[model samples]
Target: MRLHHRLKEKVLESVSSVLPITVIVLILSITIAPLTPGALILFIFGAVLLILGMGFFTLGVDMSMIPMGEGIGVQMSKSKTILISLAVCLILGILITVAEPDLQVLANQVPAVPNPVLIFTVAAGVGIFLLLAEVRMLFQIPLSYTLVFFYAIIFLMAFCTPDSFVPVSFDSGGVTTGPVTVPFIMALGIGMASVRSDKNSNSDSFGLIALCSIGPVMAVLLLGIFYHPSETVYAPSEIAVIATTKDAAREFLTGIPHYAGEVTTALLPIILLFLVFQLLFRRFHRHQLLKIVSGLVYTYIGLILFLTGVNVGFMPAGQHIGAAIAQSPYKVLLIPIGMLIGYFIVKAEPAVLVLTKQVEEISNGSISQKSIEHSLSIGIALSVGIAMIRILTGISIMWFLIPGYLISLIMTFFVPQIFTGIAFDSGGVASGPMTATFLLPLAMGACEAVGGNILTDAFGIVAMVAMTPLCTIQLLGLSSRLKEHLPPRQPRAKEEVEDCILYFDAED
Candidate 1:
């Protein structure tokens, strides 16, 4: 009965998440960038799948991954063996990240480096950084200092790496904290915080994703130094040709097994890890265990469906729309279009919902979920708009990234510490599989049409989507902080102040 109720709620959330994108696409098609009928049909079908898939995925993660991760964290904290705890976090990080579907999308796109190697490199980076986050939480260190330290290292490495490799490297970081990894690892941080009776432990729980994001950037930059990519080989491909609805239907049908395998591989290790940990600690009782197993089943099925639809239905349309707009007379329109898409697309990200709700709960409604959502949308809109400009003009990604990170990091001192951590984590959550599947392809298509380097110009859309939020959300924190310190609005009116004085005098 509880599951039934949750299912209805999730379905409502999914519709709200997906419906805007559908409407935007429809309006674009009718007015300026009409999709081929078959592609249109595929996109329509994909939207249906996306809504159902997200609904199931949200409910499943709530039931299974959250509990499993928190339980492990609690047990690991109880054990009091630092070495063992570090080892477990390390192993857990690599395992969960290896099969991340977002990472898979990125791995397939990067040239020269083998996909498995890229995956492994990113997985290891995540593990190492997850270890760092755990240590930071255990010691109750300020999250800002850790972020500044690692990001400084990441930027310094960027200067040494090949230009062709920089954007992809940064994007790797953004994609690592995706749907499969975010919930468990984030909950893992929460669980680890259980041992620390400090006031800031909850805030510290959030930065694991932020630190883990940096690892992939550094790892990929190092990989780029070793593996030089040829400039010409990184060109984007022509959009897919879909002659009929039958062809689009076939395209989606063909994609089901590939994503099925990918999502199954992604979920398998997590299931095993949960099982092994449960056996060792017996944290979950029999009824809880049954519920978790049931949730895992939902997660697995939902992911398979979600991935298949996004890759097959969304990618081609996004690319075609980008190419069409790029080739149109008023090509600068890509900026507003990109902005609109970015604004709405983030609302559809599954991990985003998880992060926002957690933030609201953690801050005790001081940080509302609505505020986070709006900040994320606006940040992502600016980022995507900047990305489209980059593609149109062939500007180096460094021009945006260097200043963006510097401003965001500098803002850390001015805002609330919790917002800084949440803002940085928001960067990764906002750039989940949806960005990888649709937005990057859109940029690639536009880059190709504008005669730009797809490698340098096109690839950093994810990084941009990941970046702007750090500044925007922290600015939000700054705004709230100022409001708190504004000296009670100067007593508004003299009469109002006199009434307060009279009340106090009567009490005395």
Candidate 2:
């Protein structure tokens, strides 16, 4: 009964998140970019699946992944040997990232690099940086200094990297930290920090994702420099033709097994790792173990449904709408339309829900999930608008990213440390499967319509989405800091004022 009630609450949250985007798409479909009846029906079904998948996913993460990650982190932190903890962090990071389904999609896109080579390269980068993140936390080092140093290196490499590969490198960073990795990584940070008695412990829990994001960016940048792939190709998603409701159902039906296999593959490592830990540590009781087993099942089902819904249902509709808008007389409406979609779209990102909830809990409600969601939404809105400008004008992405990172890194010095961590983490979480499947396709379709260089323009929308939240969420932190410093006024009593005046008069 308790489980039923929790599931109800989670589904309600998913409804609130997924409905806005659905409504926005519907409005666009009927008014400007009219979708076929079958396409419209598929999209609606996809939205329903998304809501259900998110509900199950969030519940499962709360039950299984969070506890498992936290348990492992606490056990490792309790170990006296630093080398052992570092080794464990590295191994876990590599294992989790290598199997990430989003990373696989990214690897397949760049033809110059062998898929295995790219996958392992990105995974190694994640493992190494995750090690470094742990080292920083162990030594109680400041996150700002670390961010500044690494970003300086990243920019230097970006300048040296081939023009076409720059966006790919940044996009690699965003995709590698997909839905599977974020929840575990964030929970691990919390567990690792829990052992510390220092004031900085809570703040330390966040920057792990931030730092992990850097690894893939740097790795891909280096790969680009080495490969110098002169002309990267962009393949627009093939929009499925749905003439009948049966065809739409057939599309979803075919997608289910494929996603099931992928989700199963994606989840196996975590499950195996958990079992090993359970055997070694016996950290959980029988009841806890049974609940976790149940949660894993929920997570499996959720991911399968979520992936199928997005890839089969949402992708075609997004591409169709984007192409329709770009081909219209009021083509420039793409900017505002993209911005509106961006505002609601991030809310539907599965990982964003996990990140925001964790932030609220870690901050002890000092920072609310609603505030984080709003910040992320505004950031994504701006990014999609900027991306549309690039699609129309064919400008280089560097113009935005360099200055954006500089500002974000500088703000790291000004804002509270916890905000810096959450901000960077938000950047990655905001660009999950929803952005990749829906927003990227939207950009691609628009880019195709405008006859723009899809490689240069459409490829970087994820990077842009990943970049903006750093500044916005940190702005939220800055506001929080200012509020702390500027306390509310309390009116002085008339008696006290009179007493003070009388004393002054006497003294005079």
Candidate 3:
């Protein structure tokens, strides 16, 4: 396809993805929760930017990040020495993660740990686990066993860790695997798997994201145990007040520079790493290199626009709506309302789009993208409903999380191996910047209105969003497995049956 043609297609897809949420918010504003004019205007503006940003971002990933990651992974697989590949993977993990925008948002939310402290700790955790993931894939190890073992350790630590930190720890896992991390990690896994001629190579390419998610949770839980910070308070985002169109425009314009810098910081390390790999391996020709550079430029601009829109434009609207709903007599509607929003909101997550497309490609259309989308939507709806329940009743997050994880883990054995990997990865992908920028703020707003403990009640929405996909997608896989095993219908031994079989055979 021509470049302009492709870009248009992507933008249109983004529109389909973002439009539902926009309509939902608009309806809520008119009926149940009236947003300030300024906030509503900002939200409409943000939704437009979100559509454009996703368009460019997904196209850029197709043009650059996926190729770069796959090329590097292929080269590493060809390396004669194991030590060199391991060292390189560790460095790549840490470098890419340290300045991740999602991780920064997460760090800022938790005032207890210094930003640098939490950021680096989570980065290190990703680095170590990424290395472990590579080894497991290379050695042909089963993904389920590793997940089962690590999760056991994680839950044990959760029991010992401070109560306030449990939700944050799980939230950390969701935020760490954001737009920047998922594409590269997933592509790298595919490249690594390409070298293996075994039957499990395709399935093995999937579990890297699953393992990487575990690291942050485990690391944060350990931090809770040993690193004692005096303040464990949660700081909600400050919503901007705008009185006129000029002020709204000014607000977004002012945000551009800040987000540009943040996006630059996030992309710089990946660019540098890509350059180094290109120099060492000479992987791309002149035309390919030019294309990659163009793609990088698209990625840079797209991310800046995306971050600015969501953080500046959407955050305030989400907060105000939640607060308004919570204060009203009809607060009981929060559960169904949240579920409705969650159903469409996952489509707006950039990483989720990347994951669904990749799954479809890898499965050669055996697993349709529509099916994955529906499953994730169902899962997120349930999760957000659960989160709403927690906010209303002030229930312990552990009460839900324990059973959810246990069920997801138990389901892993019954599903196909490929589904197991995709399920866990979807869990991470479903809870990206959209959940953080909008859903978390929404939860916090409602929590504050109800006079509940924000740390305990509002903080675990992302974790819940992350957890449900593991079970729902696995259930999807289990259904497919059963269908495959069912006995084939015997052709009726009659003239009509013979004629039908003969007709189909003739057509073939």
Winning candidate number (TM-score): 3
Candidate 1: pairs in clash: none
lDDT (10s digit) by residue, model 2, range 169-253: 8998899888899999999999999999899999999988888999999998998888767666756667677888898899899
Q: Give a tens-digit lDDT track for model 1, residues 338-455.
A: 9999999999998999899888877788899999999999999999999999998888989999999999999998898889989999998999989988898888888888888887
**lDDT at 42 for candidate 3?**
94
lDDT of 3 by residue, 191-246 (tens): 98888888998899798889889999999999999996555777877778789989
Candidate 1, residue 52: CA error in Å?
A: 0.6
Q: Which portions of model 3 show Cα errors greater than 4 Å?
A: 490-508
Whole-model lDDT for model 1 versus the true structure?
0.87
Q: What's the TM-score of every candidate structure? A: 0.94, 0.96, 0.96
Model 3 TM-score is: 0.96
- Which 10-residue window in model 3 sums to the lowest lDDT? 228-237
Q: 167, model 1: CA deviation in Å?
A: 0.8
Q: Arrange candidates by TM-score, highest first: which order?
A: 3, 2, 1
Clashing pairs in 3: none
lDDT of each: 0.87, 0.91, 0.91
Q: After superposition, how far is residue 383 of candidate 2 from its true place, in Å?
A: 0.8
Angstrom error at residue 81, model 1: 0.8
TM-score of 1: 0.94
